[model samples]
Target chain A: MVCRVILPRQFRAPELFPQVQREFGRLERIPNHVQFDFSQLQFARPSGVVFLSNLTRYLRRNGCRVTYCGLDPSRDPIAYMDDSLFFEQHCGRRLLDSSQPRPTTRPLMEIRHTEVHGWIGFQLIPWLSASSGVPETELAEFRTCMSELFNNIQDHTEYDVGSVFAQWYPQEHKLEIVVADFGSGIPRTVRTVEAIDSDANAILRSFDEGFSAKSRPTNRGAGLHYLRQNVLDNLGGNLRVHSGSGVVRFEKNGNSHQVKLCEGSGFCPGTMVELEIRTDRIEFDEVNDGSFEW
Target chain B: MVVVVKDLVSSCDTNYDGMVVHKHVLSALHGTDSVVVDFSGIPNVTSSFVNCAFVALLQDFDFAQIRSRLHLQNVNRQIGNLVRDRMKKEAATVA
Candidate 1:
């Protein structure tokens, strides 16, 4: 027996017990003892929780033999399986208002050189902000920019050694995300965007279009470009990039400021991105649901 | 074969009969001469189902063996027209 699972695109899986029962009834001619195969299903929203629960219940009630394949068997199911985890940790985080006294002043958590996975970054940022009482809007922007930067580091930085260290200052209303590695830097990532090794300035120019690096697959290369627009241009944040001894500082709604490279103190062999998101005016209610006692 | 017929959408529950349909259309075409494949209940045919059912069978059976023996019966007007207009495009790619 075969139970072909069709993956739905929408976020919510409306329980269709009637439809499922009808489908099963129509296929009742098949013997009960035959083995059941479930394949080719994809989940689009709320991650996978609702669907899994419904499927498990249906299969159990039917007394059908079932086999599952092709599902991404990640060890930690909650990270991807729970849709709320992404929002609670990323988009809905709280940011301290620019006007209020900072609620949390802890240094940004530092994750150095161990490869930064997407989920880890997704979990870490909001995890850090939980203490700060960040505003929701700022948290959303932070999640977007942070996702782009973390993805860039994962895709671009291929090296012998690497690390990321970050600290968020509530009093200053700024978050510093620093990723450094002793490997190929942005200059190398730039080469794939264009044919020439164009000087550091031209390389920086490539960032304006948010073009993706040709060397990588499935990349929306606009991570840095998006970071530039939302963080700096839209939200009045700051972006600083240092690649191969070339330093460029970008302030929201301002001209690109080029500065002399300091003697490799903040610079090492890889890329270190420092982004300051202003969050001094936001209140705690804006950051969290105000349901948790912590 | 259970065909799920919804206007403009047809989903076939070929779960049990899929293997038979696969074998007839791919290798033993003559083996299915007495049987007619019914997609009347299918309202919409999806790629995921096709990929899971039809495309998968092609891996084990050869096409020439079952082309003529496989038959689609009770094709509804709305579903049939929909198939002609929309599914035809996909059929070309899948075929």
Candidate 2:
């Protein structure tokens, strides 16, 4: 049986997740082939691009033939997604007509599960700095944050692999990074160590300074907390985490931090983290502090 | 004895990258009075690296013993802060 999915018009986090969950459910039930129609997709956030790529990859891995149809180049006109080659690389074809020229320049860096290693910082820092004009000092914080997120995938998730998509929009002065996995969601993982009532509460607890699902010795759960500190608190960025049927968003405004949480309309199989950093507002002084005696 | 962190761990991004070095350091501490983890050549590190390499020691060894027997030397401000922050947070959790 072939499953057909209609892409959402506004593809973004906290909103696009429910649609994705419903579509993913359809894909799960169908065995042979899957077709995704993107004619209705007018706009897509960085997270949406990554989500699509991940979903397509997941479907193909499960012995399903996937195809894309009804993507009108003129109507969609998503420059960032096009520039990033997310559609061509993931869907394995160009969306626009043959006459329309695709962007030759690649705007994003895609990392598969096998390529992640200790030298990832070296690979990411230069690309990020070149794209966003973020100084090496500021990029240092990002390197640490990325390492934590990727490490979580390796340690916490049962999936052997995960994918990360990152792009810096120089015109918009923003950096978008999305990391996703196809393993059990954060709430289910946390439940292995301690009982939790809801996925939303699990997500909230995951951000606590020392909350960890694993046992002692290897259970230092400071990764997400430090990510939140580096991105939202230090760089004044925005963070959204979608896992299972829960979503939590954190944004820094002026000197205050705002957090919002809600239940997803449908269930996401694993976890997706979307972070947006305002490159123009990132200050090195805020990141560079002197040595610590302790 | 002095253990150069850069010489021990080639990269500081992954968890096992740090955990392996932590094991080496733990072995060094078996016979020596103290082991100074020199961070002169290493440029940077993430919390995950530090957690596996240093903070996890809190679970195995007493904090007072770690303070006395394991010394961090030639560390940059960035890594120092990372280690200190993770140590402080883990300490609270363990307490």
Candidate 3:
């Protein structure tokens, strides 16, 4: 038996994710052969490509013979993925001849949690510093955010590995980052802490400050709370988390946040965290060094 | 005893590394009146690392004992606050 799932025309994430879950989430028992058709994919964001890469990984790990077809490297969308090194990293095949990542984007990558601190220091921070107004020292603050997500993947997920992609949109003055993994969803991990009604509620409640992202039963800023406080609240940007059959989108309002929910939208395996950070609000935050008081 | 954190060459991000640091520091605490942990070079750290390495000590030692014995040197406000917040939260959760 074989299953063919054609890729979407507009490959954009936080939106493309639910549609994918609806298509592939139910098929835990995948057919022996699975063909991912990228013929219609016209445009793709860095975050969206991370989802696609993780989807392919999950399918293959489930004992399915996965293959991709209907790709034209000459086209912009397929070429973009090639330039980002998505195919080479995900499929061991290059779609284009160039080996460099695109201008404002980092290449799609899979990294283990243990190596994330160094990766952020050596790879991610330098790239962001080169492309933005934020200096490397100040931008290093974002390393805590990455560390939080990586720690969650290490503690909660079946695999300690995570798929990451990032891009800076200079025109929009914003940064979009996607960190994803194929593991048990956030709702399952939350269930271990508190009793919740829906998966969306589970994720929403998990955002409470002082609550650890995983099992420590400690209130730490290194988990979802830091993501909310640092990005959505301070920068007045947006954060989207999709886990299981539910999705929650939080956008910064004047002082608070606007929460949008899409519950019961088919089960999505694992969790994906998307952050749209406002670069204008970005400044060096690690500047205060005077007092260690209190 | 003085511990220079930069010399550890540790990742200081994941729980596994956190546990390693915890064990090392705990061993350093034995038979010593106090241990000074220096963070001159390392600029930032994750809560996960602080939790495993410092907050976990609350399990074995009281806060005052930790305060008297575990003195950190040359840490930024962010690191101080993280240790404080994790300690308060863990104590609250335990209570």
Please name the candidate that would achieve the greatest DockQ relative to the true structure: 2
> Judged by DockQ relative to the true structure, which candidate is superior, 2 or 3?
2
- Candidate 2 local lDDT, B1-22, one digit each (tens): 8888888777677677789888
Q: Give the per-residue lDDT digits (tens) of candidate 1, residues B40-93.
A: 433323222333344444444434322333444554332233223322333444
In candidate 1, what are the lDDT values of residues A255-289, reduced to their tens digit? 55333233222222345555566665332223332
- iRMSD, per candidate, in listed order: 21.7, 3.2, 3.3
- Kindly provide the TM-score obtained by chain B of candidate 1 when compared with the true chain B: 0.43
- Give the DockQ-based CAPRI class for model 2: acceptable
Cα misplacement distance, residue B89 of candidate 2 (Å): 3.8
Model 3 regions lying over 4 Å from their true place: A14-22, A210-222, A285-287, B23-35, B64-70, B91-95
Candidate order, DockQ descending: 2, 3, 1
The 0-to-1 C-alpha lDDT of every candidate, in the order given, reads: 0.41, 0.72, 0.75
Q: How do the residues A98-192 of candidate 2 rate in per-residue lDDT, one tens digit apiece? A: 43222222233456655765435566666667767676765667677777777776655677777666656677777777788867778887887
lDDT string, candidate 3, B1-95, tens digits: 98777777455666555677777778888858888877776656777778778888878777777778888877765566666776767676676
Write candidate 3's Cα lDDT for A1-294 as tens digits.
667878778886655665666666555556788787889998888767888888788778888788888888888888888888888877787975665687798778888876777888888878877787776656534667777767765566888788888998998878888888878888888888788889998888878776555465543534667666767755547888888888888887788788988887656678888878766776555566634533
Candidate 2 lDDT at A70 equals: 73
Better of 2 and 3 by TM-score: 3
- TM-score per model over all chains: 0.40, 0.85, 0.87
